[model samples]
Target: MLYGAMKVSVGAGLKVVFRPRVEGREHVPARGPAILASNHLSFSDSFFLPAVLDRKVTFIAKAEYFTSPGVKGRLTAAFFRGVGQLPVDRSGARGAGEAAVRSGLEVLERGELFGIYPEGTRSPDGRLYRGRPGGLARVALASGAPVIPVAMIGTDEVQPPGKLVPKVLRPGIRFGEPLDFARYRGMEGDRFILRSVTDQVMYAIMRLSGQEYVDVYATVAKRQLAEEARARKRKSAQE
Candidate 1:
């Protein structure tokens, strides 16, 4: 199968090239359904995380990655599929959240590993932003799976936002102790409980990543930066 072959080939190739140092992998459950909740830094976060793991970690990706047209798009789609990523429509926030949770639940029900980013989007400034919950709480609660906090250090520098090729930099992957939310089992509908659970996960990630914590969402931070850039450009033009 393409998945098996690529997993071995890609994993071997990356080990030789990036020489990633993975720590705390012992925390990942060798078998059974578990949530790998991590801080997103670069596009390579998905690839690097799964590459290091012995088990196949499936993550929900944007549908555009699968639905793009033409030869290049097909290759991209195939590559994502080969690497065990599921495509979900990320259009409306509410709808997309629901769809992703549903897909994740299905994966968990099958007793497989599911990966998610608690921060919703990559940190634009490398500071760990406030987690969006983004149904991560709901999924973990619903699936009754232990949440493993993972940190992908130095990935942003190796393959930054706009870069396609990665530099031969050693990134570290650390997995923290698994967090159990058994007490909040039946309270998935509680927004306050969700926020609390998500914050706890983010805190664990912060400790592992050693990145400065920002109180705002990454998307909001990016928007603010864009607006500030526009304002500066306008002021310069007027001057």
Candidate 2:
């Protein structure tokens, strides 16, 4: 009920204001379970993608969003839940990945759309990063649902990293055709198969979004960037 209400009210309002250019929306299955594997560019990627879609799309968010203390935390938790987000503990990579896969599978079992960022984290730069195969691959293989590659174009411009408020930029969304991995149905545990499937999805997203592909994980890229910044600072001080 809350999700529907928000979709109609808040979602509708944002659509009117932003007026995002959406393409290939018809590619999304009108009914049944499917996985939306998208490139995560900005925090708003979550909101913008679901806002334009007809069916409810659920994404797994960090547990902190739901577990924060006090009034602000409560409100944040409520808002995320209202927007069809499930909270997953992200302390341990393996455990968190497993938990996310479980949540995604549950959503798919209910015959609803599940949204995932195959890249694992938001891109530090606009370049698309290597995808993490564990959650997305496991869920799709387990659920036997078609995976759709979605691209959220120009979202980073609207709300870049570390920005609180979004600018009035014309973001665009592109949905590629569904990718069927029925042949690898029972190979969920196979790491090689998972990587192959994830790479294919990422490649499709790259084509749709037209972002330069980076072969490293987003988290790694972020770390490298921070290291570079520290190095520059040290060099400046020495000079």
Q: TM per model?
A: 0.98, 0.99
* Cα lDDT tens digits for candidate 2, 1-239: 99999899878987999999999999999999999999998999999999998899999999999999999999999999999999999999999999999999999999999999998999998999999999999898988999999999999999999999999989999999999999999899999999999999999999999999999999999999999999999999999
Off by over 4 Å in 2: none
Candidates' lDDT values, in order?
0.93, 0.95
Predicted candidate 2, C-alpha RMSD: 0.7
Q: Give the alpha carbon lDDT tens digit for every residue of 34-61 in model 1.
A: 9999999999999899999899999999
Residue 30, model 2: lDDT of 92
Which parts of model 1 are misplaced by more than 4 Å? none
Note each model's CA RMSD in angstroms: 0.9, 0.7
Model 2 residue 108 lDDT score: 95
